[model samples]
Structures are given as C-alpha cells and as structure tokens.
Target: MKGRTKLTGLVIFRGDPGYEAARKNWDPHTDRFPKVFVFAQRTQDVSNAIKWARENKVPIRPRSGRHSLEVNLSQVNGGLVIDTTKLNQIKLNKKAGTVVVGTGNRVGRIANTLAKQGFIAPFGDSPTVGIGGITPGGGIGPLQRSIGLISDNLLALEMVDAKGKVIRANSKCNSDLLWATRGGGGGNFGVYTKYKFKVHPAPAKATVYRITWPWAQFEEVLKAWQRWAPFVNNKLGSELSIGPKKGGNVSMEGLFLGSKTEALRLLKPVTSVGTPTSSIIRLLPYTEAVKFLLPPDPILTQRESNQFSSGFGRKPFTNKAIKAMRQFLENVEGQFAGFFFLNWGGAVSRKSPRSTAFYWRDAQFYVEWNSSWLKPSAAPRNIAIVRQTRRKLQPYIVGSYINVPDQGIKNSGPVYYGANFPRLRRVKAKYDPKNIFNNPQSIPPANHKR
Candidate 1:
C-alpha cells in the first residue's frame, strides 16, 4: 500500500465519514460503491491518483460534475474514482477573443459567467453537466447552429495521460490528439484538466419563444417542425418534444438571435401548421435568453432511475417513421417518458465529417427518447420501452449520440463514431496503447482485438 501514501487531494475510503455521499451520481441507476474517491484539487493530484491506481492494480474512473448517465462510466465497485470538480476555474481574455476554462466547471456556471461579460460559448441543455464530459462528446444545444458545437470552439487542452504524465494538445502540438478529443467522447483518452476555447460576443438582444399544441396534433406538428427547423434561418435554433398520451403534449421552444419581427417571419413555416393552443414569444437581452432556453440549475444530488437512447436523422422522417413515433407515444407508460428533437445543420454541417471525431455533420436533426421511474422494480419495463422504440426507428436514424448512451448497443464503436471510428482507434493506440482509460463502450487501441 505504498502508493496510498503518494496519493494527494481529499481521499475518502469506503468506510470514511463522507463515503455515503461521495458514491452518488446524478442518476441513481448508475451509482456504484467504489473502494475510494480522490477529489483531485490540481492536475498533479490527478496524475498521482492515476499512478497510484496502476501500482495497486485498481480500476480507475475519472469524474466531473457527477453527471455520467451510464453505470461504471464515472464510478466502479472496488475501484478508485478521480473527481475533478475542485478544478473549476474561468479566465477570459477579451483582446484575444478566447477563454481558458477548467474542465470541472458546470454548463450553467460557464454560461452565466460568460453572459455577464457580453460573450457566449456553445452549451448543452442541462446546466449541471460538466464541461469536461460534454466538450469531448460534441456538445449541442440552443446555440449549436449559431456558434457551432462546444467541441468546435475548443482550441486546445491539458490532460494527464495513463502513464501519469501531463501533456498538451492543440493545432500545433499533439494536433491529432486535439482532433480526436474534440468529439471522441470523454474518459476514452485521458483526464482533461483544462480547455482553451475561442469565444464569441453575445448578441445585444435575442428572441425566445415557446409554442404548444393539443395532444391530437402531435403528428401534424412534428411533421411540420422536422421540415422547417433544420432549414430555418441559421440564427434560429429550435427543439421539439412529444410525450405519452397520459401527460404530454406537442411543444416547440427556441431562441432566435435577432429582433422579434425577424423571428416571427422565419418561424412562419412551422408556426402556421395548426391552430396552436398557446404561444409565448418575447425579446430579451442575450443573458435573459440564456436563462429562458436552458433548464434551471440542477440539484447535483437528486437521483432518478432512467434509460436514454439517441440517433441522428439524416433527412425528414417518412410517413411510416412518424406513425411509429405516434405508436410509441400512445403506448408508453411512465410519468417521465417522451421524445426530444433538435434541428442540426447550419454551422454544424459546414465542417467536413473527417475534420474531427464528431462525424454526424450532415445530420438534419437529432432525436432521443427517455423513460424514467423512481422505483427500482420499474426499471425493466421502462428500459424495454426505450429499446423497443429505438429498434422501430432504426431504419430512419443514421447513428447514435455518445452522450446519450444506451447499454443495449452491442457494437458501439461504429454506431457512435461512424467512418471515423478507425482513426479514433489509431489515436487511442498512440496515446493509450495500454488501454488504461476505458469504459464499456470506450475506444480500444487499433492493435487490440475486440
């Protein structure tokens, strides 16, 4: 146990006073009882923890924001958890139009902080997700079409490799590593310490709107939204949702980076579909729009048992695809079950597929479904519903999103990375040939066989 003396930061063993609290993740379904948790306060601490885990032959899992949705991704039984939540830091350089941020910061804090300085960076929907995990997974949200993905803005990063060595990657040095990390997913390469991003100034005012329709109009509204959202003005980003018959309705909410008049004109296609039950549109400052578009800051310790799966839509849904969606909504039985959709293209499609590890650049829209329950006994039924729905829509969807992972996927490499899977494997082999950083679906070295 000589390596134990070498570990630094706040170490909590299994039987320690805070072990009970330290073992939890955002989703109760993914929680595990790890042997120890090392809250790394600095990059050196992360390097020390990785070396200690190797010396003791213990598995290692890197954690930030505690928001990993899948089991064993951020915590493992009888293993070590290296947490980077303490590495939170934000530095903005107005002259250079860039920002260097610690990977430990949450999405909400970064958005709020940047908005205060009259700047904006791409962000996902949930404010609680860590930048460390999201950036590598091709972060997408309301600002995606306008500013590109969070990964696209990533200019450089610092990481601690499997051999407990610190490394830097950017356009000039370790450039291939930088390319792969942009959208290759987290915990596959190494423990990222910091990210240097190219940021943009926020618009003076933006328009935010929310429109809803009766349950019966779900199919009509969906068809209209799918056709219009992706082709609408690039400055406008929209999301559509449909839920079960028991508690959900068809709704669309979004942000338009312009005056309300321009937003209404561009929204004519979908907004003109059916008689809407309600409509709310307002012009607000950029910061206010951020608050309106994103969900409220989350309670980190709040937990729920849930199953989620996602795919990219290369084109508008066919009639059969729409029918299948209707059937799922009509039959699903859960208080928290539904489908979520976001328009793709615009700046996202401007980048070639091979330019980065995120190869779904041609996707016209992105769709995902989730089933959640509070009771342990309800897990099977809820999980089955999502799996079944995925199968029915498989023909129409191209690939799955790594961020919204589904354990049911047997061969996940191609499903998540597409044609870029081979290149990613080569990069993995070069930096982590020993395969020290891995999870259930993590990329394996090219020399190793599945």
Candidate 2:
C-alpha cells in the first residue's frame, strides 16, 4: 500500500468529517463501503487518483451526479472513489453556438444558464443530474425531437485515462475516442473533465402543455399516445406517465417549438380523446418554458427507494402488451409504481445508428418502468413488479437505455449498445489498455483478461 500512502489531493478516508455524506449516492439501493474517497478538484487530481489506484492495486470508480440506476457501477466496495463534484465550471460562447461545461455541472443549471443567454441544449429532465454522466449515456430530454440526444450535440471532451494521461478528443484529434464518448456509457471510459456541446437558438416562445385523465382511462390514452406521439410533428416532444397503480392518474406532457396557437392545433386530435380531467396549456418565453419543466425538488429524487428499467419500442404497443400493462398496474401493491414513455423520432431517428456510438435509432419511443418502496421489506415485491412489467413487454420492445440501467439485464452489451459494442471495445482497448478504469458494466477491451 505504498502507493496509497503516497496519494494526496484532498483525500478522505473512513472517519473523515465529510466521508459519510460523500459516500451517499442518489439511489439508496447502493450501499458501498469504499476504503478511500478522493474529491478531485482539477484534471491533475483525476490523473493522480487513477495512478494511485493502479499502483496500489485498488479498484476505482469515478463519480459525478451519482444518478446511475445500477448503483454498483459507480461505487466499488473496499476500493477508491474519485469524485469530480468540485469541477463545476461553465463557459458559453454564444457566437460559436457552443458551450464548454465542467463534469460537475448539473443539467438544470446548464439549461437555465443557456436559456438566459438565448440558447439551449438538449438534456435530461432532472435538474440535479450531472452533465458528465448524461452526455455519454445518450441524454434524451424534452427537446430531443427537434434537436436530438445530448450525445448528438457533443462536440468535444477532455478526459484522464487509466495511465493518468490527460487527453483531448474532438473532430481534429482522437476522433475515435470522441465517437465512443458520445454514447458509450459513463464510468466506462476514463474520467471526463470537460465537455463542449453544440447549442441551438432558443425559440422565441414555446408552448408547454400538461393533459391528464382519470386512472380508468389509462388504456385509451396510452393506445392513442403510442401511435400518435411517435409520428407527430417533429417540432413537438411528448411523454406519457401512467402510475402509482390503483389511485394514480395518466398524464401527457409535452413542449412545442412554435406558438401556442399552432401547438394546440397540432394537438387537436390528441386532446379530443376521452374526457380529460385537466388540460392546461400555456405559452411562455423560452427561458420560462424551460423553467417549467424542472421538478419541484430534485433532492426528493435522491431519497426515493426506486428501481427503474427501460426498453425501446420498435413497433406500436400490441393489444397483449396493453393488457399486460393494465394487469400489472391493477396488481400493484407498492406505494409507487409507474410507466413513462418518452417520444422518440424526428431528429433522433434522422441520424443513422452508426452516426454516433448510440445505436437505438429505430425505436418508436422509449419506455421506462419504475417502482418505489417505502421499507426494506417491500423491496423484493416492488422489484418483482418492475421486472415482470419489463418481461411482459420484452417481445415488443428492443434494447434498453443505458441511462436507465437495469440490473436484471444479464448481458447489457447487446441491449444497450446493439451493433456498436465491438467498436466500443476497440476504443476501450486503445485508450485504456491496462483496464485501470472499469466497472461491472463498463466496456471491456477487445483482449480483456476479465
């Protein structure tokens, strides 16, 4: 452990003052006990930590927003954790239509910052989710229908490899590395320090709508949405949330890229469905519209004991799939359980599967099944419900979203990356030959021993 003794740069061990707080992640299911935690403040710190882990023969994991659904991927028991939460710095170049953001910057902060400057970038809905994790995992947010995935907008990145070498990847240099980072999944590559993204002009005024129906109408609403949302205008991004089982409601919320008048006109067919309990639509400045999407309190998301699984719908939801979903909801005993569908098409589908490292271009919409429990005893049942829901829809869905990692996926390489896995392995071999940066689900080198 000579290397461990030599390690420096704001290291925190077992009984350190902030050790308890620092070890916690967004998901409560992950209970890891690392021997050491390093709060890296600069690119040099990240490099040094990697070198120390290698020399000391200790496993390591780099953590940012700590939002990985597969908790073990970000926490290595009895190993070392290199935290990049202090590297938050942002610079926006409006003239170039690009922005460089530090690894620690959260999605909400990034969105609000860009909105004020009359620009915006596609990112996740959560305000506290970090850019470091989302960018590489193929961020699909409300604006994806128009602009594309956050990975699609990534222009460049800087990272520290397993050997403690700082490298920059972009169109001009290390182009392969840049391609892999786009959607290869986070914590698989080296520790990311910064990302430069192409931003789009903020619309003059946008429409935000939230339409809801009683729980009894979930089927009718879902059927219409499964067919309509995917083929709807490219300028619109819509999502459906059906949940909490017995007493929950079914709702559809979306954003339109044009005036409120046009948005409503386009949504006429959808709105004309069964009696909606509530229909609220409004037009606001681009900045205001963006703000409306933020969850009331992101901190609550971290405290929820939840399991999230995802799948891609390549075709319309079949009658059997719909029936399965209804039965699943009817039998729910958990305090909270739901399914969410995010529209996928337009700009997202316009790109070929090989265009970037992300490979799910043929999906109609992405489906997320989530279940939450209040006590430890309720976990097994809730988890079973979530898994069963995924199983029922397996025949109709293709692949899963990397961002919403599911522990049930025995072999995620094919599901998450599809045909892009081999290329990702090559990139892993080239950049991290020693396999110093790795996890349970990280991309393995072409000749990896493990």
Candidate 3:
C-alpha cells in the first residue's frame, strides 16, 4: 500500500500504454506526448498532483477538454500533465437554474443533458468542445445572442490553487479570481474541476438558414452582408459565412433563433442583397438545431487554421471595408474551406464590457478568419491566406479570439484578456505564486517585481 495511492488519482509514467491516449488532443496538426499524465479522479487527487509538481519543479499543463488550438496546454515535452478528464461528474440544481459540471464534460453531452430538461448551456461551435476550457475563454456559440456567452452565465467555479488547496470563486468569494475566470483563458489560475452555470430555458424550436452563392457573385453578397449583418434583431442570432465549398464555389451560411416564417421575413433584406445559388430555411426542434450548427462528433483527422483575432463593429461595414473584403475573397484560390463571421449582439451585448474580465462588449460581430488545412504542405499556404485576409479586413477589426490564436504573438496575456490582462496577472501571482500551474499560456506570476 505504500506505493499505491501515492496520489489520490491514477498516475501513469512515461512507458505506460495509456500515455498515448492521454497525450493526444483534438487538433490533428501537432502531436503532443507528455512523459507523464496524472489522470486526476477527484479534487483531492488534483491537490496531490499540484504538490508533487511543485516540489519537482515540473512544468505543468492543465487540461479537461483538450480542445485547445495551441499545443501549449496539451503538451509538455517531458513534464507532467494534470489531466482532469477523469473528474467526470455533474451536480444539477434546476431550481437555481444552474448546474455544476465536471471539467471533463464536452459541450455536446452537456447540451444534450440540459436540453432534455428544456435548458441550454452556452457552447462553442463544436459540440465536442469541453465546458471546462470554453467557460473561461468567453465561450460564444449558437445561443450567445439569446443567453450570451458561457461566461455571462457562469455563477461560480471551483479551482485547486497552485498550493494544492481547493477554493470556490464567485461574486462573493475571491471576486478577482471570479473576474479572471469569466473571460480570461482557462488553465491559468489553477486546475478548474467544476463550473457552475446559470442556464436558461431554450426555445422549443430554432431556425437555421443556409444560402450558397457562386464565386462569381461573391463581391455583391459580401458587400450586402456587411451592411445588414450587425443590425439584425436581438433575438435573431445571425452570421454570414464566406468560404470555399465543393465544386470550387463560395458558401453563405447563416442561423436564426426564431420561427421559419419569422426567419424568412427577417432574411428578406439578406436575399435582396444577391441571388443565392441555393437557399434553404426551416424550423426544427431545438435538439435538431445541433445538427445544422454543429454536427455530431465525427471522428476525422481534422486540422484547423484559425488566426484567432477579434473585432467590434459599431457601424455597418463601410464601402472601403466592403471593397477590401471583396478583394480578399476574390484573391483566394477557392478551395474547400471557410471564412466565418458570428453576430455579437442580442444577449451577448447585454452585459457591459467591464462586467467580467472579457472585453469587446459593444462590438457587434466576431470575425474568425479561420481555415482548415487538410494536408501538411498546405499549412503554410493556408496561414498566408489567413494573413492576407486579415490584412485586408484589419481596419474594420478590433481584437482576436484566444480559442483560435495566430500563434505569432508572444504577449497573449494582452491579446487574450485585452483590458483584463493586468488583473489576471495579479490573480495568477496571488493564487499560484509558485507557478505550480505552469504552461505556455497560463498566467505568469505577477510578483516577479512586485
């Protein structure tokens, strides 16, 4: 028994066969195989691992959903990886309209569970994305316009500090940590074992609209979408997608949160912009909406190229910006890919900028100039496309999304947290001064000079 239960969790060394599974992440681009993966089964196990890593001075990487864009949080060459996937448990409170979720749960599973009870949680575009990671990174998804980002709905969080002590944060206790947890990227302060969400009743049915436009008419559709996209109805969650599709054509995809009849009426202005190659709009059960927005978890060797930048749109896309977008869309080789634009109003903007650590309160749209490189050699070319596209649209953009960062910027503290970076640094130093929660993106202890 001396050797057993050294930690309250299952600890596997470098040669363990299970290490292969624990080392991998969702993104197929980079392969990160950590030397040791401590599968934390409980909060006590998490605390034990923290003390071990601290004494050994091992660089620690925290993970739950491993749905990370950058390889930092998922891989640490020879260091220890504290895996929270095993802490899979959920405690629901229907009366409070909240649920404390295990970090291990993915958006799809959580959404399905909650939807059964007529409740919905804010999730990312991918259903497989973990709630642990997205909740802290200012999660925005199909329901953002209705319930707002996942952060907005966050009521409290339970985290294990760098010193192996567990604490809960919210408006009442550890208010600063609460602020940092809202919009600041996760895995910084400590290992978040659970998240309490303020969920809401979902619509009985949602309407999704898909309209494809030819490559030849990209400019006209692009110009018109820029004008009408930001000012749409608050209840109507909308987005305009311009990207490569099958047969070398561009696609314009959109989603609305109301009846198909009302959606058709709301989309009249959009249809008038240009003739869609194929337009389809309909109302379906709230659960079916998941298929249209985020298809079921399909196992594929998928590679994503996201220049994770963000921008706010206070006014309509100007002629200059629209013309610039047209030029960039026309410049692409038009392969099988996509450029996405998500609406930022409705419930998303209801909270003020300073309400939580996340900024971009008044901004109306989040432009994710993302691409998918199916092949290895295509990575460089795809990156260049991202740069060129953003360069053309930079004037009209403001900030970037941490979920899909460019990887070029070193000071991600500013890029990811924006105005909230400084406070985040202080929080990191206060709770994790020893830097037990160390990773490339984890908040660096701010006490170095203080």
Q: List, residue by residue over 1-450, the lDDT tens digit for candidate 2.
A: 676435656899878888887778777777588988988888888888888888888898888887767767778788888887888888999889999999988888889889888897776667878788999999998799899999999999999988888999999999999899888999887999999999999987889999999888888888888878888889899888898666788888879988889989888777888899999899989888888876544562454578889989988798999888888778765455788899999999999998899999989999998887667787788778878888888999999889898888777787899999999999999998867777777778888864
What is candidate 1's TM-score against the reference? 0.97
How high is the CA lDDT of each candidate model? 0.89, 0.85, 0.72
Give one digit per residue, the lDDT tens place, for model 1 in 10-70: 9999999999989878888899999899998999999999999999989999988888877
Backbone collision tally, model 3: 5
lDDT of predicted model 2? 0.85
Better of 1 and 2 by lDDT: 1
Please tell me which model should have the higher TM-score, number 2 or number 3.
Answer: 2
RMSD of each: 1.3, 1.6, 3.1
TM-score of each: 0.97, 0.96, 0.89
Model 2 residue 34 distance off true place after TM-score fit, in angstroms: 1.6
Where is model 2 poorest over a 10-residue stretch in terms of lDDT?
295-304
Model 3: per-residue Cα lDDT over 312-415, one tens digit each: 56566677876665555554443435566777777877788777888777776777655555566777776676666666776777767766666654566766
**What lDDT score goes with residue 2 in model 1?**
59
Top candidate when judged by TM-score against the true structure: 1
